[model samples]
Target: MQFQFHPLTRKEATELISWRYDRPLDIYNIKVDTDSLQNTVDFFVDPKNSYFAISSDLHEFTAFCCIGADAQVPGGDYSLDALDIGLGIRPELTSQGLGSPIAIATIDYAKQSFSPQRLRVTIAAFNFRALKVWQNLAFLPVQRFRKQNGGNEYLVFIRNT
Candidate 1:
């Protein structure tokens, strides 16, 4: 199938409002907060952040990610010049070989726009799919931290830009 990326708009924001968190994957993998999603959409819709929705055949919003400049590293790791980007695919799309290319596109966009020295990805420790995807894309483990949600902590992956 064909794929393309579109800027998330107000219309898309409204559509996300209807996104049901009932997918089996959501119960175990995704951390969806309605308010946060809405706020992110509102912020990215601004001209400043290069956030976009990935689509198949330019028809469906399969995934979304953001590109930004000089994101502060959470643990004062000055070596990390960029922020770990956020990405999400509709739960139905999981384990379907869609993440790598979409992530590569976002990384390429970030490299072109921000020229960061490094790129990072933070994944929930229990989310094996995400860990594998990021690892496949050459993101190496840099750190880990305890999360209030319990279980294992989040793993941070870093890739030099």
Candidate 2:
């Protein structure tokens, strides 16, 4: 499957907020309360943030990706020079063997567009699937820490660009 990346729009952001996942993965769900709707939209639409929507040849929204400072979850020491990134597939698509292609596409897109020195990604410690995928891609574990509110443990992985 070929993936096309495009700047995320306000409409896509709102659509993304509606995506819900099963247990474990549910932590990724984005919620925009009424009061924060505007701010949420602002953060997603701003070009400086590198928020993007990924689609397939059919033009259906398969996933979303974000890179740089915005992708950093709180509590991780991001002082290292690496392009941080995050990727989420639509709920129904999980565990369907699409991870490698989607991830490869996202990595390629990030490398071509950002020209970063290296790439880093943070994953919830419980998400073994993602950890395995990144490891298979040669990303090694670099650090681990709790979320900002002292939530679940998170692992940071890095791979050279």
Candidate 3:
């Protein structure tokens, strides 16, 4: 399946916030709370963050990703100057061998948008699937720590751009 990145639209953002994945997959879901859909819409209308709606050749929204400093790492720490990235595939698309393509598109978009020496990704320890995907993409484990909020263990990986 061919994939491409496009600037996230308000409609896409709304759909993203409304999407809910089942059980285990929900663990990695993007958490956004706003009083109204418009508020949620306003949040993503920023130029600084490279927010992209991952779409298929048919222009269907398959995933959402951001390449920016807002990526949260456990303890809010990172050793190197890097572009932090976050990604999420559509709920129904999980475990379907689509993550790799979406990830590659995000990384390629980041590489073209920013000139960081390295790229950093923080993944929940339980998300072994994502860990393997990043590992396959050549991102190496750099740090492992627990989130103070939920105490969920997280692994930070890095790869030179």
Using all chains and alpha carbons, the TM-scores for the candidates as numbered come to 0.73, 0.95, 0.89
Query: Which candidate order results from sorting by lDDT in descending order?
Result: 2, 3, 1
TM-score of 3: 0.89
Give the range of the ten consecutive residues with the poorest summed lDDT in model 2.
57-66
lDDT of 3 by residue, 25-116 (tens): 67665576565768766666565666788889644898888787767665757757888999988887788888788888888888887877
lDDT (tens digit, per residue) of candidate 2 on 30-131:
877999988988898899988999999744888999988888989999999999999999899889887878889999999999898899999999999999
Candidate 2, residue 94: Cα displacement in angstroms equals 0.9
lDDT by residue for model 1 (1-161), tens: 55566678877655544555444345334344866876755765775776677777634887777655422224434355655576777666667787787777778866775677888877777778788889998999977876555544678788987
Scored by Cα lDDT, where does model 2 land? 0.91
Full-model lDDT for every candidate: 0.67, 0.91, 0.82
Cα lDDT for residue 123, candidate 2? 92
The better candidate by TM-score, 2 or 3, is 2
Off by over 4 Å in 2: none
